[model samples]
Target: MKPLNIFYAEPDADRWFKYDRYPRRLIRRIFRGPQRPGGVMMVAINLMKGLDRLNIPYRFNDYRYINKHPEELACIIGKPQVLFNREWKNPVLFGAGVFSHPIDHAKLFEQYPNLVKILVAGEWMRDMFEPYYGDKVQAWPVGIDTLHWAPQAIEKTHDFLIYDKTRWINEGLPQPFIEPLLQTLNKRGLSYRIIRYGSYNSDELKQKLHTSKAAIFLCEHETQGLAYQQMLATNTPVLAWDKGGYWLDPEYYPHRVQYSPVSSTSYWDARCGLKFSGHDDFEATLDTFMQNLHNYTPRDFILDDLTLEKCALKYVDIVKSISE
Candidate 1:
């Protein structure tokens, strides 16, 4: 049998998934009919690339939410043999299923319960959901676009920039640590300029990641660290927190990527790139970050790790194993 046509929907306007490019490439192969939104990135990105690789045809039903037109979305989903979600009309196609960070699982599950095949980012998360949705969990970490992620050597450039839009403060992340991080920058005196944004637009955020030095992600309630991969694609490092491990890639380190342990939440391990739990310790972390900044190159991140072909293979597995 041929592939299935999928209609992927990412209506999270509040926080765009920033996955436009991915869907475009994936809608090409193994598609016989319409496809619906699967879980988060692992499923979404993989399926998107699978279709794209096989040159399978598909649809992008983004209008479902952006335009508030479920009727239009229904039409786009078209008729299929098996729908990905029960809520999805037939001949419906389901990719992996829905996935969210630790904090948002309950709410997300409530909203998209039909979302089957839950995909997780880290190992622990797979365990976390084993009780609630046992045997359905799959570790689908983020992938990087070597071509798009590569620093154009000219796309954009900045020295040691930390950009985050999350209201970590309002979320009780504390400001004591932040002060130290800033102070470390001040003491380093490298003129490290920090960039930040208020709105949560994917395009705007991607632009920031593509052009900045590194991402300062302090979210204590995140699902996956797809954003970190996006930043790595731009040759940027990441200074992330442990509260978000379920979402962040475990490969993250203190050089190309540094993270905090939940226990060490009060403090960050200062390393090649440096990780600090509190901004108050920023002075110390920033001091190390500056001292070793030049040595911590982008190559350390391995931006080319996830290739389209490999991702396509994973998709083939899902499509082949579907409950035909």
Candidate 2:
């Protein structure tokens, strides 16, 4: 049988850029999709390459054509705030995180019973969606292109690279946690640089990761922690927070948003890196991290779990299972 036509949704144009000159830019025009300053765009681009490698025919954000033809597959690749219609017969939500409220997701699923599958980023998400969507939800984290993201033979530039995003403060993590952590690091006379969200583009970010010895990631929450994984892909050990935040009100900005004890969605480990619970835990772990940074072989963990080929093969299997 001929492969199904996969209509992949494109990332928001304004939120992303075209960095084709970068060596890491995967398959030309097709795989070279828009790039957000962060990891989301890279995830979309990698998935595009995976689709190409598997010979799955695809189009980006052109819903009119896919909508007109009911037989093709519609793949939503990011947070679906708008521009989605329940028109396609084989609709699959791939790598979607917590964009809508739980109640909203339930309504969408009920409205579109033809929705074949909802592939999310981690087991935590799978658990979140399973109760409402039943067996349709599955875990499918974004894969890494290890070829471009792997550890290099270059010299390490910084002792500790602080990967903190301002969004974390708004979304979940408060200043109490972040400010004190930074103060503690400064007091220890640690050499570090803080790279905020919009400070670097895709190529520059990759280059920065390659040069860094270690990182401290302070993000609110992630379905898969793509940036954290990217840091690990560079063999750069990371210390991340294990907790996350959620929306209780689901009505407004930071809508009833507050920190909650939640399961991590990444393949984090001592071998790759560490996760701290609070200020005390982080402070306690700092000494161990500095002393044995070399012992943490994060690149290997990423290679084993988050590689392009591995993700593509899994995607193909999922598609086949649904199509057949």
| Residue runs of model 1 more than 4 Å from their true location after superposition | 10-50, 53-116, 155-157, 168-177, 197-215, 243-274, 279-283, 297-304, 322-324
Q: For residues 22-136, write the lDDT of model 2, one tens digit per residue.
A: 4444444357565453455566678777767667666777666766776656566664533253445655554453354344556666766666777777776666667777887
On residues 14-116, what C-alpha lDDT tens digit does candidate 1 reach at each position?
2235765556545533463434323253445554664576686545554334244332212112212223233642222233334333333444344544444
Looking at model 2, report the run of 10 residues with the lowest lDDT sum. 6-15
Backbone-clash count (model 1): 50
Error of 2 at 94 (Å): 5.3
lDDT of 1: 0.45
lDDT at position 23, candidate 2: 40
lDDT (Cα, 0-100) at 125 in candidate 1: 51
Query: In candidate 2, how many Å is residue 17 off?
Result: 25
TM-score against truth, every candidate: 0.57, 0.79
All candidates' lDDT scores?
Answer: 0.45, 0.67
lDDT of 2 at 211: 75
